[model samples]
Target: MKPFLTGHEELIHDIKYDFYGKHLATVSSDQHIKVFDLDSTTSSWILNDSWKAHDSSILRVSWAHPEFSSSKILASCSFDRTVKIWQEQPDELHGSGRRWSKLVTLAIESYAPIYDVVFAPNHLGLKLGCVGSDGIFRIYESVEPSDLSQWALTSEIPILNSSLPAKSLQSSFAIEWCPSKFTTTEKFIVVALDQGFIYGTKPGGGKDDLQNSPRQQSPLQQQLEQQPQSQQESRYIKLGNLPEHNGLIRSVSWAPSMGRNYHLIATACKDGYVRIFKAIETAKGDLKIEILAKLNDHKSEVWRVNWNMTGTILSSAGDDGNLRLWKCNYLNEWKCMSVINTSNRSDNRGIEVEPK
Candidate 1:
């Protein structure tokens, strides 16, 4: 936990480590993205690459592919009501094969900024989702274009469920995909909401192209609209109450386990605590969830909690400028592994600014 770099005008919204934990990526509201090498001996790792990514404060940065191996795609969400995709063109951008540059830009409703973006884990063919100020969740595809900055909307989920009020709780701050089920029958992505909702959804399709969109045709008068009956559309499965945090649950992440009964999910919150929950089987033979542990050592709002690729190691940072690492014991309870105190400086996770 040495001082990696100093003197930035904004908060660090996010920090992502490569799968092998050998590299690090940090995004700050200063409108700057920095990539660092964990094995650098000179304290200052080479500035692999950077750019003036967003028009406003950048809220989040995510690696759209698996670490080290195939992480050429980078996704960023910002307060400027847009989501942008970047590519790491090794041979062209950086001589060493680790440079990332802007690839695409998605303009959504004005002021409806994007907060989070993440590619589906263990997924093939390249796709990712971004959710932010507008309370809308959009899916983007990695289509190879003559201009890499070009991307298309593969699917757009304006709402996760029909049951929940569409406009009531659209501002989703956290989202995560369930671990690869191996069985294709149950493909789902979990979205954590600010209004105490944790639900799942399967990719249905796209609504309309947000990038390079085409004009629509109103041919309803010719076909009578082929009026159809109202069919039940139920792609989302509701888990249960996850109010372990007193206020809004800020972030949620899962462990890397396949067995249904061997899964764990952790959440950080404005309540200033990180809670771990494991799946439980009920007497009715239904799968349920139980709280494994609650780490309240973070003295300020716990902005985020993320698991390492192994899911055994956890890292969390907050408004207090404290970054902590927690390790799970045999008892399933997690203990503090390491702590990074960047106090006296406002944490990046908190200083994010999103448009209305």
Candidate 2:
């Protein structure tokens, strides 16, 4: 792997690549976002743009599919309790230069520090979902695909289960949408809470109305209901929680279905293990989730997990400064294919040597 100095003063929190992988975006605790462009000629990453995006630490950044709009867009969530949308535009002053500009800012009513933000697939239109310290999951939709500024709060649902205590909720959570290519109208999102429980939900349906359920509604949901009828019709219906983890969950990723009848989800937790789940659809269209595998190769807390574009391989990072890759065999059992040590070694003179 090649490394590039990002010039970030604080620790970097998250990094995301565009749908085509031509561009990369990284967010840092220094409240900055940097974009990089891959130079096809030299096969090296070049710094494209860098800017301070928030007053507080920016935790996560996500890139929207280019098919949703004419230009590329990015969404970022920060500890300042705001999620900002950015768009790439041609620089009028400098010829052949591109610049990223802020398009819109979404502030939650609870004012809790946002943890994660992700954009839905291209087929879902211009929709974004976010989760935060407030234990509320929010979905925002762009009414006009041509205008990114025209966004509406479509759904807001509490992520905590009815049996879980309010104090059990943590300040960090991760969420990802199922990338099933078969269904166009149906959408499913998997959420992992730092309190060790993962939940799935299907938001917005014909009979799912929130007008009469004010007691269970979030502040943002109640506020959205006072808007025009067309804007308040969306609601979130809970699908139920998954098997509990022994420790806090750090990240969750849903693999691309790619015409498959079943969906795969991977989760990394503080227990130094990675768990994979298989969600299959029954003949009647009901979804069922079952534990597929428990991988205990990591010796430290697993921090992040993600799948490749084809969803054939799984990658994970951990606090031990190591990266591990996993793949399935003919028997459908996931095995660790390789391990990369990220920690640097120091010589007798105390000079640090990079891993080769």
Candidate 3:
């Protein structure tokens, strides 16, 4: 892979590619956001726009679905305790260039430094989800798609199911929505705090086609269905939590199910292990999670784990300064496919600030 310099004054915290994979966006501790477009002829990325987006370190950046507008849309969260939305528009003054304009700032309900922000899947409309040091997860939806500045807070839920012994001053979180195209009954999201938790919504109206699925309830399913009617009628509810994590989870990713009957999730944890969980839906609509693999090859605090588009492979990065690729073979055992060591690289462009 070719690497290019971003020319930021400080370290970058997050980078994301747009839905079409033709553009790239990055947020940096310098509090600036930069956008780049891929040059087809040269097969290289060209910087398209750059602007100061926040008052403090920007932690994450997410691209809205391309179908949302003719021009691209982006969302960013920062340690400044705010999230901002931006849209690309022609430079009115310059008349020959394009620039990104801030559409709105969401800070009213923010209580702590925001750590993560992500856009919901395309089918879910233009919704943004964010989590912060306060351990609260908040969702915002566009009140009117055509009017970018108008947004409404639709839901806010604490991530942890049980109270911690005391307040955590170092808490951070990451979240990802299920990217399944086949499931029409409900939408699901997984959040990582000290542990992983799966939250879901009940079918909103009319009739659910999966209503006829077998009614033999699993223990987990029974507990979820036993929640008070208030929770059952809410926009979203806590469906289940994952196995305990040894240390705070740094990142979590839900693999695209690709129409499979099961779901796959991966987590990067400060305990120096990358764990993969396989979740299967019972006939009664309960989710049963089994540990598919526990990999300690990193031997250092892993910071991120992500699945390929097809969910056939996973790539992890960590403090060890190695990017490792993993895949499952015919025997259904996961093994390291390759490792790219960046620790000894002499290129300044490869250097990154370790996450605090």
Best by lDDT: 3
- Candidate 2 lDDT trough over 10 residues, lowest sum: 207-216
TM-score top scorer? 3
Q: Every model's Cα RMSD, please?
A: 9.2, 6.4, 7.3
The residue-level lDDT of candidate 1 at 165 comes to 35
Per TM-score, what order, best first?
3, 2, 1
lDDT of 1 by residue, 1-356 (tens): 44556334788878776555666677888887766665457545545665667788887777755531344666777878787777766666542434676666775643566778876653333456777655556655444423445455544445434443345553446667655443222223334454434444322322221121211321122232242312112433344545555676788887776454456778887778888877653443234667888888988888778887667788887876778999978885679977765654435543324344
The segments of candidate 2 whose C-alpha lies over 4 angstroms from its true place after superposition are: 92-98, 161-170, 190-234, 283-285, 345-356
17-123: candidate 2 lDDT, tens digit per residue: 89888888999999989888888888878888888899999999999888767777999999899999998885532222337888999955646788889987665
lDDT of each: 0.60, 0.73, 0.77
Ranking by lDDT: 3, 2, 1
lDDT of 3 by residue, 1-356 (tens): 36789988999999999988999998899999998888888888888888888999999999998887888899999989999999898544322234888899985688788888898887666777898777678877676666878886656777765663244445658888888856644445545467777776654431112342112211133443355544433646565676867987888888998768889989898899999998886564457889999999999999999999999999999998889999999999999998776874534555544555
- Kindly report which residue stretches of model 3 are placed more than 4 angstroms away from their true locations once superposed: 92-98, 161-169, 190-192, 203-233, 346-356
Distance from true location, Cα of 131 in model 1, Å: 0.7
